[model samples]
Target: MTGHDDWVPFEITPGNTGAEATARGLTAYLQGLDDLAGLLTRKKALVFRDFGVTPEELDVVMDELLPNRLAYVHGNSPRTKVGKNVYTSTEYPQEFTISMHNEMSYAYAWPSRLLFFCQQQPGTGGATPVVDGVRWLAALDPEVREAFKDGVRYTQNLHGGMGLGKSWQDTFETQDRAEVESFLATTGSTWEWKADGGLRVHQDRQATIKHPVTGDEVWFNQADQWHPAGLGDETAKALAQIMPAEDLPQNVTFADGTPIPAEYAVQIRDRGLDSAVDVDWRTGDLMLIDNVAVGHGRRPFTGARRILVAMCD
Candidate 1:
């Protein structure tokens, strides 16, 4: 994409696909297309609109999009698993906007693509905005970009069943501690199990990543979302007053553990949103995004809305 104005996703409707309004039609159209991954990397995002894909046909449509669907394991967002590998998109309050960040960018491994299916439309707003990671990085102030060159450190304090944020069980999607440890071992992360049945984990990762196929270096960390400043004044102050930085449910800092300035976090969050293209949802709409190339977030809305999300490697 050249810039924000030219960075909108490539939309495929009935006109482009020459298909009927059915899931089987979508699958056939996709099955005939060559190098879908190449197209996704070039377009960054894809919209399959007016397909009228029913929930019963979701799995087939998703299989055509890409296979090896992944569970939302180790995900930090507030969500509910409603299917084998599908989840109700971020359950953050409808009145509040969620900042842009790649799905699971804070972790050691992340999905290559994310598919969102809108099961119900909201009364107003609730658009899923996507930001081109390259453009997002380019829009940031040079000083801010330079400061994050070395990447950042992330900390998570997951409780057993009670306390702040997400519980270890929900975070890992398993009751077996051995499974959790086995997963963590592959991430090169350090973790501690507290006497109170809490899990504290620390991981350091780079601020940017290069796409495997396109070889494009893009902004790829969740620093702003993990930092206190990004949590808004009231929440940040309340958390700080209650415990030290390391004790928070989630926290981030410079790779060296130095605090990231509130202003930096603001610039990062605001710039990403500013450069985003909002994809308004309609019932039965489906969207697929190349997770590394584009980061996504939600716009505030009203009334009932349900978007199911699934990802693939």
Candidate 2:
């Protein structure tokens, strides 16, 4: 991976791709691709700026770039599905920054690529900051990395139809218990249905994984995001006082069932954000990221922001 200071998306524009670029936009860019996957694998990320990509034309561009876009099923984040396999980016308060993580890294399966389109840019600061996974891994303290060497266990306590946190129906995108059970079976998760009509799930996953092509080890778990420690102190304390950590909507622990220290979680979260390179948004701009190689998050902004995201295998 390249140095964070020097990292920038490989940009292509109408001016560089010639007259046909104006007519075809991203399709023209796709035509020039000898190997789209290879290019993304090498660069990790690419930006298409000033291509005049409109929402109406986004499907064509998506077809060319991500031929097999996958549905956002079993996704934990709160997002409204906008179209086939596409959704608005996490609708967190514009004042709070979303920390970095590889999409669905906590799951047994994950997307190979993630694409983002900026339909509307925010007034102040809504940049989608991205960090090279390998770089982020290296940026952490050696002790912190060693502590997570074994792996991490993720736990989710989803409610039935209505309760705290995400409902089981929303998490699985299906109301059928049999269907949810079938899906969980495939993921190798241990689950139990509660008397109160809730569900508890547990899955152990590696904290680090090697990139398929590069063979570089990168931090690969969403431990920080899942652990209460990553929440601000006030919120974490308040939640802890209300419910046991194991009963929280989401939580994480060491693979051996040891607790991960709050300071360690904070360090991981802060370092990932500190090491990221922010991609400032512009309306009509699009970004494609090799998900295994890069982790992305949103920065706080003032006015409205509309960024759509889709993922592919």
Candidate 3:
């Protein structure tokens, strides 16, 4: 089967039997799977609408429609409306732009798939954009790609805000310092002290990793995005000269102690943003995207905009 340009729309009538509606919904999902699988190798996104079902009902249908368990659930609310808060709520109202990067790149375990349900769309702006991370990485300079392949290290300080108001001391209240150090060491990360006296840990991770399914290397890391260790205002200003606005004050280094150029970092950011395709959302619309292949973000909107998100592995 080939992919279709138009999305399949269905309506559940009041007179239709429950079983009949379910059968039809399942059929649509199957058709979508067939079409998506034929066109893409690693991922496919399907938009569903007018299924005449509540979110709870859709959950049941999705359980059967997709083979894997729904893994990551998130939202754009002031507080988390669904699953865990990966980042602190303090970063709310921050307008995110679409960039090509894997979900949870820093985590030891990352989700292989992602799904987003748009409960409400903004009156203006706030489009959902996605990009192919693998494709974009391949287009980078050979030297740049090689440097990334050599592995890179980043420092993530999950002490205060990232820990969601839990200080480093609080998080390890029961655990021994040696044990915490061992855990960080096992991850190839180092630690330091923040100027304000909070614990600042340096975490080293891969800059490029092979997709579990596609076996192609994708550039992955959030080194340039947000800094783990909160830097002092004066120190931050000085580091701004050396690093891009996107790269935080924390140092980023190659496995062999080589520093990644600020220019290259900007290139990666630009390419990621360039590859993304935005979906103009409508109220009550559900948009599903492949997290492994695509990175998603939002535009700032005035007034209220309700959106719900669910991530499936």
Candidate 4:
């Protein structure tokens, strides 16, 4: 593994590994790896470039990288399941930028690694920028960092079958109320079922967390993504026009129930994006990210794009 001047992802190619630039060769290379997790932790992210890996052969590569893939349960993103555990990356509008956030950072548990395979590249400006979690934390002002020391409280209003945001069935991937309740019990969250068939849930999570393996403190919460203040004024007003803040799809505040200032959310969102480094997409390119050490986002594009992602704990 070689470094590229402190870039977010360390790239690997046929030239460096002495492996043939083909799907079969990429599988062979992964099969030969001794400590995949350790390598990913150190590098944070790895991109396989110039390798002609195909959609059909993606499972073979997944087998070596993600031995036990996970379903996208308890996730907030809008995506469609494509393969067994593979799903289309967040299906936000192609013209809008999806800010950086560690996948499922708001949940009780999250995938340790994320694997992305680019099936089709956009015509222009569609790079998936990645941010180093440690660097993002350091990029913030001391006061902002200090304010988040007590952690954050996240709230969600998932309707039953209609109305704002995602329905509980879609969010939990199940229609059984018992199943949803059982899962929430394990997450240490407080929840209530509204008379209108909506599910309101709350979770308090640490704003910063230590990497389990390396013990490195990194920004790991999704306060900005969930808070209305973090969203631009126009969008915030649009959402407000639809419903009140508490009734919105999702919301966030400090652990003690105090409101998180709009300025803080804006600072976090801006600093995170500014510190990110893009991993430009190319047809057949693959990227593997250490979820705890990095956060991922999308860049606005003008054309069609198809990127499939799968994750494992």
lDDT of 1 by residue, 15-84 (tens): 8778977887888889999889989989999999998888888989999886889989889988999988
lDDT of 2: 0.89
Error of 3 at 99 (Å): 3.6
For candidate 2, write residues 1-313 as lDDT tens digits. 4554467677777777663444265687687779988989888999888887889889988988887899887778888899998999987888998999999999989999999999999999999999988889988999999999999999999999777788999888888999999999999889999999999999999999999998878888899899887878998999999999999999999998999999989999999999899999888889999999889999999877899999999
Off by over 4 Å in 3: 1-43, 49-58, 65-98, 160-199, 226-251
RMSD of each: 1.1, 1.4, 7.1, 2.0
What number of clashing residue pairs does each candidate have, in the order they appear? 0, 0, 1, 0
Task: Give the better candidate number (1 or 4) by TM-score.
Answer: 1
Per-model TM-score, in order, reads 0.98, 0.97, 0.65, 0.97
Give one digit per residue, the lDDT tens place, for model 4 in 189-294: 9999999999999999999999999787889998999989777889998988888887889999999999899899999999898989999999999999999989
Q: How would you encode candidate 3's per-residue C-alpha lDDT over 1-313 as one tens digit per residue?
A: 1221222212223244233334356445545454543333433455555444444454555454344644332111133435332212212463544344566676555555555555556777776666556656665788878777766665444343353233554444323556666655655556765665456565557777766556655667654443322223464467676556323434556657666676676677666666556666666555555555555555556545666655445
Name model 4 segments beyond 4 Å from true.
1-5
In terms of TM-score, the best-performing candidate is 1
Local error of candidate 2 at residue 3 (angstroms): 4.7
Clashes of 4: 0
TM-score of the candidate numbered 2?
0.97
Per-residue lDDT of 70 in model 4: 97
Candidate ranking (lDDT, best to worst): 1, 4, 2, 3
